[model samples]
Target chain A: MTRFAFTVEFDGRPFMGWQRQAHGPSVQQAIEDAIASVTSEAVAVHAAGRTDAGVHGIAMRAHADIAKEIAPFRLMEALNARLRPDPVAILACEAVADDWHARFSCTGRSYVYRIVNRRAPLTWENGLAWRVIQPLDAAAMHGAAQVLVGLHDFTTFRSVHCQSASPVKTLDRLSVEREGDRVSIHAAARSFLHHQVRSMVGCLAMVGMGRWSADDLRAALEARDRAALALNAPPDGLYFVRATYPGES
Target chain B: MTRFAFTVEFDGRPFMGWQRQAHGPSVQQAIEDAIASVTSEAVAVHAAGRTDAGVHGIAMRAHADIAKEIAPFRLMEALNARLRPDPVAILACEAVADDWHARFSCTGRSYVYRIVNRRAPLTWENGLAWRVIQPLDAAAMHGAAQVLVGLHDFTTFRSVHCQSASPVKTLDRLSVEREGDRVSIHAAARSFLHHQVRSMVGCLAMVGMGRWSADDLRAALEARDRAALALNAPPDGLYFVRATYPGES
Candidate 1:
């Protein structure tokens, strides 16, 4: 028996998300089927994050256990070959110890949300970015984001269906920057509540548009209710950038 | 009569090309329909470049004549409102002199071709970039590109069906650079023979991959025969970045 860790990239547009569902295709099912084709084994993959539909993954980490012995590079080649037309690929494969887990061993994660702040309807990036007709004050949005930092109960910014044991999560960083006509929001943390990043970005956008204030955000956090939060940003703009482990750099 | 000059942006994935065709939708037809909806006058748009299918446009310039007087900014908004779900938008509009033409008045044009040089199949930029699985040598590609700069008979790089009377074109700049796993080829010129940029990029990519040599490229250019060049690069990776006029900043 051997354990292998794989770095993956996916479009997420055609799948029903990362997890398998009865009704539609998923990134997980695609990889699992590819593994079955290559190794003739029913392998279940454990990912560091379960991204929503229409989201994108640049460097998602996952792990699988297989009964057959194969070279790491060959494993990558076989999986990629079998995963055709699905817009998913295994970037790297490395043998790991039994205790090495893609999810449990992850110490840090980062995500980026994109917004095209212009009037022209999205052409190339139609389903890949949040297109806003009105201009957003990115500096003001960045200023409001500072209020949400530190250890706190993020109940107001979590999805109602979130199954996390606790709402308390420390947000290590939340920064907003502008380049040309696009606004990008980067968030980093050890772990996050479900929909936490999207919810926070949605509220910050309001502040950037002058629809909400910094004090309004503080009040929403203190409310400690899911209903107090603004709308969740669309999944298209969210990207699971990377997962980090200790001494893995 | 009023003449309006507009800058447009489009995804270009669905259209046949920039010019109208009887068999399929084109960017010109979409814009013409949108213009007729707003002004109730039949207008024919003339663009600086007639881009091929699957080629995106960041800031394509066009000119049209309308019978009624309309503010440039308002016309842009009205046209955008009518473009529907075709992924086309008017970025900006301005009144121009009757003698001005979209194609004739352009002093310079720039294009960017994006190639993803990595093992992972493109997820985030699936349709936006061309995926090259092998590693590309950017410095080598850049070096080879320098040989094609300046005035020359570009028949070897022109499409066989190109209708231009003369094959002589001057390339102002042909630069290749890489950022992480992506390689970008930027081409600038006062004007280009049809399919010149894509042809050059196709050959340069071959050189970068070591499948062809710099000497082969020079021989192809000097041959002055259409059949001397390699295949034209796919339109999926091409973008008409912008068209610059004499007085515009």
Candidate 2:
């Protein structure tokens, strides 16, 4: 068997999420079905992250093992051709060691949340960004975001439905920036609890709008209670940007 | 009568074009119907440029003459409220001088064409950007674009059905820029003939792909014949970005 690593991009609007579900379609099912059609084998695909519904992916990494001897480029092209009319694409594909797993071999992940800080309702970016009518203080949001960086118990920022065994995780970076009416929040970490990025961004947005002070946010983190969460940003604005792997720049 | 100028944004995918059509929906019809619903008057809306179908607008300037005694903010808010579910928005609205016109008063216009130079098909940006599979030399495209800038009788670039009285128009600027996989072409001029920007971009793309040389582009312009046109780009990647008016910074 040969293992292949694929960098994938998807819109995440129509699917239920990355994981397969009995109720609705998913990105994983789409790819697996496409692979089955091409290789006649029901291969399961594994992704670095199982993004939520309506959350986009810029370069989500995944891996699948196949018994057929196929070139990586040919396999990618065939899968893409079979996945036509779907808002998913294989950006790059390469052979990987049999032991290299997409989920367990990743070292870091990064995400960006987009906010359109304007009164106008979104047109082109309707499902791609969050619209904040009131102006945002990006500088203030950035200053407050620093409090969430480094190792900490992120229970306040995790979803109640999260299945993680522990809430303690090391956040490598969190930054807020503004350009005209667009605000972007970037987060990087070794890993994240379910909905942690969205939850953190929600409170940062509150700080940006002056609804909550930086001290209030710091206090919420200390509380480590789900009820202490100020808000949970919608999935529409979140994007899984990239995943870093060992020995790869 | 009160002349209200509106800065509008829209995703043109669902519309036939910017102009009102007899058999299909148009951005003009949507906004006009919204205004009529708000103020019982069938007002005619005029835009700085009549963008084609599937082309987007960022800050398209438009104006309407209304007899109803309504504040600009109120009219804007009402229009937006009524334009629900449609991919259109009124970004800004204000009273303009009685004689100032959206079309005739416009001194300059600008457009940007987006291209994703990658092998992968687009996901979030599908129908919003043109995907070029081969590599592109943006620097070479920019160098060739300079040949089209300045006063020229661009019969080769104008559409056969273009309604402009004269083919002689000055192109103030044409620039190509690239950031990673994204390439943006910005064009600015006092005005443009129908399909002018798309035609220019098509030839520039050929230059980027090494299919045509800069001298070939210059010769095409000098030919000044409709048959000399190499290609006309699809409207999906084109965006009506801005309109400049007299005395407006």
Candidate 3:
């Protein structure tokens, strides 16, 4: 069996999430079904991160093992052809070492949350961004986001449904910036608890709207309690941007 | 009667264009109905530009005369409330002079065509942007675009159905830019013939894809015939960006 690493892009609006569910469709299920159609094997697909419903992926990394002989280009074209009618695309496919794991071998992950700071109702970007009618102070939000950087117990920012073993994780970076009427929050870490990025973005938005002070954010982190969380942002604006591996440049 | 100038935003995917149509819904009809619902008067709405079907608008300037005594804020809020279920919004509304006109008083108009230069299928920006799988040379397109940025009889770019009396119109600016995987074409003029912007964008795209040269573009313009047009871009990626008035900053 040969292991193939795939760079996938998808619109998360139609699926339940990345993981397979008994009730609804998923990104994983879509890809697995496509692979089965291509190779006639029901192989499991693993992703660098399992994004939630309504979230988006730019270059999400994944891996699957196949027994059939197939070129990377041919496999990518076939998979994309099979994944049609679904809002998913395989950006790239490459052969990797059989032992290389998509999740375990990942050294870093990055996410971005988009917010349109305008009173105008979203037209093109309806479910692609969070709309905040009130003006946002991006500079202030950036200043306050620094409080969440570095190693910390992120229990306040983690989801109650999160199945992680521990809440202590090292946050490499959290930055906020404004471009035109859009404010983007970018987060990078070795790994993250479920809903951590969205949770932090929600509180940062509160800070941007002058509803919370930077001290309030620091205090919330100190509380280390879910109840202390200010807000949990909707899944619409969140995107899994990229994942970094050890040897890949 | 108070002349209210509105800054409107809309997703044009659901309409038969900006004008009122006999057989289909339109942005104008939707807004007009909303205004009539609020004022109990069938007021006619006029726009700076009559954008074609599937063409989005960002801060599109429009005006309507209302005889009812209503505050600008209240009217805007009511209109927004009534425009629900449609991807349209009144971004801003303000009272203007009696003689102020949306179309005749407009001194400048600007449009943007978005092209996603990527191999992957678009998810979030599915119908909002044109996807070109081939690599585009934005710099070349920009260089060629300069050839059309002056006084000329733009018959080659104008549509056969254009109702303008004369084809001789001065184009203020035409620029092509690339940001990551997205290529944007910005066109500005005092006014434009029907399909002028789309026609120019299509030819420029051909230049970007290395199918045509700068000399070929100049020759097409000099030909001054609609038959000389290479392509007419679809309305999906076209957006009526802004309108400039004489005194507005």
lDDT score for candidate 2 against the true structure: 0.95
- Please report, as a residue range, the 10-residue window in candidate 3 chain A with the lowest summed lDDT: A118-127
Residue-by-residue lDDT tens digits, candidate 1, A37-147: 999999899999998888888889999999988999998998988898788989889999999999999999999999999887887787788987677999999999999
Residue-level lDDT of model 2, residues B1-249, one tens digit each, is 999999999998999989999999999999999999999999999999999989999999999999999999999999999998899999999999999999999999999999999988888798899898879999999999999999999999999999999999999999999999999999999999999999999999999999999999999999999898888888999999999998999
lDDT of 3 by residue, A1-249 (tens): 899999999998898999999999999999999999999999999999999989999999999999999999999999988998899999999999998999999999999999999876777678889998889999999999999999999999999999999999999999999999999999999999999999999999999999999999999999999999999999989999999998899
Top candidate by lDDT:
2
**Candidate 2 chain A, which ten residues in sequence have the lowest lDDT sum?**
A118-127
True contacts kept of 2: 0.82
* TM-score, one value per model: 0.96, 0.99, 0.98
Which 10-residue window of candidate 2 chain B scores lowest in summed lDDT? B118-127
Instruction: Give the per-residue lDDT digits (tens) of candidate 3, residues B126-145.
Output: 77889888899999999999
Q: So what's the TM-score on candidate 2?
A: 0.99
Categorize the docking of model 2. high
Looking at model 2, the pairs that clash are none
**lDDT value for model 3:** 0.94
